[model samples]
Target: MMATIVKGGSFVIDSSSWESIMTPEDLSEEQTLIAEAAEHFIENEVLPHDGELEKLDYKLTVQLIRKAGELGLLGVDVPEKYGGLGLDKVSSTLISEKLAKGSSFALSVGAHVGIGTLPIVFFGTPEQKRKYLPDLADGSKIAAYCLTEPSSGSDALGARATAKLSDDRTHYVLNGAKQFITNAGFADVFIVYAKIDGKHFSAFIVERTMEGVSIGPEEKKMGIKGSSTCPLILDQVKVPVDNLLGEPGKGHVIAFNILNIGRFKLGAGCVGAAKDAISLSAAYANERTQFGKPISSFPLIGEKLADMNIATFVLESMVYRTAGLIDAVLQNIDHGSDAAGVQSAKGIAEYALECSINKVFGTEALDFVADEGVQIHGGYGFIQEYKIERIYRDSRINRIFEGTNEINRLLITGTLLKKAMKGELPLMEHAQSVQESMLEPTEQSDTDERFAQEKRLLATAKQIFLLVGGQAVQTYGLELEEQQEVLARLSDMMIAIYAMESALLRAEKITAKSGEKRGELASIMTSVYVHDTFASIERAAKQSVAAMASGDLLSLQLSVLRKWTRHTPPDTIRLKRQVAEKVKAAERYVVV
Candidate 1:
């Protein structure tokens, strides 16, 4: 039965199955070389122009992108026939991670390659690919995606942008405005979404030379100022009928599928940026002295460094695990086939729940990491002269990028329910199993002593999710959407579960290969993460159950939660101190 369920590609409800998933430790030599090349490019080409790029020098930004293109960085996921490197998802994730250290320059490159060009790569006609991909892949032509309107942000399909067919039916007259358009100021190609006849929501490929298309002045932003961000205006712009992307009335397909990929890539980029923050903070703590001693020696400062590194490790593990799953699905896809684009989209969409989880978790984790990075720099953290200050500012937008973290959180639970309803995931069945287990007698679980406690805690965490989530669904039915707070709590529980599982699996894999001697840090980090995360899950589950039920029912549910959550709390103070010693000694993040 489990094998049959596994073949269906549903969510892995069983904890034992997670070990089969790939981890960052599984990256092949070729993939590591690609990652190294990306790091070298950023260090040599991007960091040197940091100031010029931040000043909004669009020309310098364009030149740097072309340089990256020359090195095949822009086309990691594109098919070779389309002038791209045609690498797997892991390779693409690696490039995104490495380039993240470049700050605003990374945003520029990411937007162009992700939302801007991917729509064409995955949904455009054969002629469209032949015409635009070569230039996009090689960075000769820049691209931007136009989706958001003043009236519609997260409600994407509510866009007011309209397209009317010309008398000859040979062209579309586009009229509307797209706000906060990334790469808008200098993009040669634009993937614009508009409704045709005021009803059929669709996407169109509009070029810069179009007569009625114009770009607004660059909007000054609190962060990511170096990346061109402007409103794109379309006043009776003439787009060829053939320029329609995907099928008419199916623009949501392109919009959503592209956004799915965008969300995961954004998560990967956040992990990279967080790693940079960890390194910067550790180095600063080591050199900055307080009270005649290095700050890194202080327990409080060491605590901060340890927390930052722990979060980074968890995030890195989640991102690569997701990338590996995406690649596994894509491996069976025939890239040369006509259905390749649609098939690839389906492959990615299969993990929509996990992708949303990654997006929300990774961004929020980076925000915490960046805030600490700034704090570790002391008063210098507040000034622009310090790199941590800029990183702090730059990190703010990620929460709102690729759909706001709030929206992503909502999507996380929403997607899971939809899958459950469609029989794609056995969420309800797993919930029932958890309930049954709760009713059974508690037994002394015999397991691997090394991770036995953490593993049991993980299982209980899943039970908490099932108990609270299952009750929420029963109480509200479809109206659960109105219970935003409950939904958010469930989402947090799910996020913690995913993070803990990823960390545990990664640490287990490492320990199995290198033994306790070399994998000691990994084990410590995993234990620390799971211990804290389990507490958080317990809190979220209690809050959610209380809100959903009251009086005796609430008391009963809370009792069950306490039973499941009971565990010997690891000495996190000592664990963090130990983790921090290594971080301070290495002067950077060493556990990765």
Candidate 2:
């Protein structure tokens, strides 16, 4: 496909290959050992016990999770002072990936650590942290977040649960039921949100031992059965005033922000599962013969493998970039109790759009990858014995939980528009700066060629946003959910473009030091990323713009958009094979 060009900017092609950009990072001995330890634990401890745990045996589930905590895997992202390893987000994501190889057992651990405990670490009071977090961090006690009720799934503020302050003012009387809570049977601590005064919400840290607190029988789910999921019944339970998580009427803050972190971790897990799915398909294709030869040798199978690799790569790139952005925001700040910590909220709040974007993309991408994985395996993929079968079922919840992807789509668009309105996004500034930085071309190779393509795609995407986003917001407004979908597509186009731009820029800098071979490969991958991403943006822009139109302009613009089909990327099959080979060789998902 021919490349699209920006009017005021152009790509400076440097001769280099993706190999330079794709060079692996050097890990410290500790990092390597930690990852290996996680892998070993999953293969040995978790996989063997998957059957019994899947039956909802609370005792066995808690024991295994505690064992994981003992291995220091549960507290990888927790601070040292809080009984955690205080590792970086990438490392935590790696741990998540490894645990995912264990299937739902990984999910069990994730529930206890990621969504369940992160809120306390990020937003709890000193007393609350000291009271509940220590046990949670050490795995002595499990934790669960209670947000979804019988009626409140995505519309959290629509919750009917009530927590009325007692006449004595010492405790709050809670009367509500939270359904489909993970770690329900095992959690000793629950972060429950309840309405106060009929107009406001509050978060309360309730213990299982509290009076009138009970757990319902486990609900049989479509997947992730190993993780206990049941209802938390709180009938006139007495929660002390001290147990209130944050100030009254501020529970939405905790619910929304902690959920952002959960979405990222969920995306990371999807990446891990996608890798496994891809590997399974690739290996099966190589071994299983069809048409008198291995299926892997055929273009059809090759295309599927390529598509899987590209999807995985895009997701990993986006996930890590989002993580790195969040890490940057949370880096110097202390994530302890104390209201002073809230003063630094600007950092994390700024990236809400990015977080939601990753959630939507990662979940949807994994779903696509899983479906394709099954298709690649043909009938074998559908059978229960095949891990893909389980993975396909397990993957469905990611979109539903942590805010349904439908809600997340609204968030992605709303957040982006909000940011843009507030001047936080500066999409134009980002575009201009990237173009300026690449004005002077360096050298040339295969990787450099790819880098050039990535730039072209990004530049085109920026243009589309400038033209389309403004038109939609002015015409459709926020009330129309379809506009939100359009905004989501626009944001995705920008995100993919940004990822490619960043990776290409990094690859160029890396190549300058690593030599041409590595540089060439990085460039190739960058181009591959750009090509795939641009095509997506082009399609979305065309569809969205046409949908927004009321008159003949719709058909006219679509026809024009179709005429520009020369802008798509290279054969994805070959590009994905290259990506898969790297993933298999490293046994992990990575961009480089």
Candidate 3:
């Protein structure tokens, strides 16, 4: 396998080695302790208040966030010099995953710890970090991210929010209404994005106490009602020149990079929520009875539970794998440096492609799990009395958060193409190689080695991705960028390649360290998910090919596709039943 420095978006072109990647089984003593502490915080301090939290009680939400600060949960990413633990990226991601058990409270804390405070943590000047980080790290203050305006949702740069230099250059007058600002109700500080002189994009630290800073009433929502969502009104607010974040025109850098982090953490939160859904559903299935026995005894019910476990297992593998990659990059940064914030953002920007994929896949996966959970609960699932009902509603917002799944899907393919154009990834070269190799005779694999079959299919999936992507580019050339349908189908293929490979690496690594029996469950889960997802990969490839060509050209492409997808799929039914048994026994999503 080709192994070197792991570049962002390189998975599409290069083979991945499990040796350098992190799996759930690789958690360190310290990282495990961090996970336990976060779990305890969510269980003890956060969950007990769900009744009040569900009532839209902003005061209690503030108190709960403050408690998280006291527990040192808020400061994992903050440097120790600034009253934070400054834990590695894995620890922070672990914290995000664990806190998600509390539903709406997770959103509140996620917004604060992620987008809210990260701007200063990553891009703020020294004086700014010294002045603001201590409280943010400790949860004495809450932060909100202000970017989405009423009219500018996806087109963030088209913001009408304006800031101007005051006479004597003492302060900048800021004016704009930011819509859907999370944690806005009680956020003590805001990381506000506005245009300087209505042209230069920039970010500012706007304190709630500052004159002309006001928050609108919370908008009623479909779910996560406990989390605060409101509009931020900045009317002639006076912000000192020193409070500007990063450079004036480079605000887009801070905004976009911070979003990459947000997208990743959001994926982490979704993983936690999915596990909760599975556990709750499993418990219900075991206890609920119908047709003379427990629902858990029925094959159909077991099938649903099996599907959820498989999806979540793959998503969890990908999330932890990405966190490990970021941690590798973060190890090289010196948090004491003035440019540490900028350095942190730059290091994370490399994995923007993975982060977006995680966001898109993890969210949709959670939504699927949540919906299935509700169905398993029957009529009770729809009623408010059941927690799964809340979980189902809360899951819907994730697809729209960070960036809408639609927008992220486009970015996923767009980012890869841009990288290829800039020569950051060898995508075109790999595509060219795969095309030439297709002209050679096909080879069959009958090796008895462990995971040999899974590896072969994974390799074929990657080739299919590159093939379809190359054809789309050649057919459309510069215009391919505008073909959203083709771009989206190609994005689905890219996603399957990453998901399949991530699951395989984790499974193979686990089996290598532990005995085959100990790692058996993981191996089976990987096989099932890979087999199912590979079929999806084929469908996406053929769909795009049909759209791109016709006649003999289409037939030729179809022949190539058949050669790529000719591997025998494993017996998924048997594998899924095995997975369901383990999940049922544990009453939760499980991997050996």
Using TM-score as the measure, the top candidate is 3
Shift of residue 194 alpha carbon in model 1, Å: 0.3
Mark the regions of model 3 whose C-alpha exceeds 4 Å error after superposition.
1-4
What's the TM-score of every candidate structure?
0.97, 0.86, 0.98
- lDDT (Cα, tens digit) per residue for candidate 2, span 1-592: 2222111111111222333222123235676788798999888887887778767778887888888889899888666777888776767877887787777777778888987887777777777766776678778998888999999889898888898899999999999899999888788989898998666888888899999999999888898877788899999999999988777999898888778778878888888889888878777877788879877776677667666776776676666655555555556665543542353344555666667767787889899988988997889988987888888888998899899887876776666566555674564454345334432342322344535555555555665555556557656765555656676776666555545654565556556666667665465566676776677878787867876885776665555455443454577556666755664444334445
> lDDT of each structure?
0.89, 0.71, 0.91
Task: Tell me, by lDDT, which candidate is best.
Answer: 3
| Model 3 TM-score (2 dp) | 0.98
Runs in model 2 with CA error above 4 Å? 1-30, 335-346, 426-450, 477-482, 502-516, 519-525, 550-592
Residues 444-506, model 1: lDDT tens digits? 454668889998888788878888888998899989999999999988988898889888988
lDDT of 3 by residue, 526-549 (tens): 989888988999898999999999
Question: Native-vs-model 3 lDDT?
Answer: 0.91
Model 1, runs deviating above 4 Å: 1-12, 16-19, 444-448
Distance from true position, residue 521, model 2, in Å? Answer: 5.3
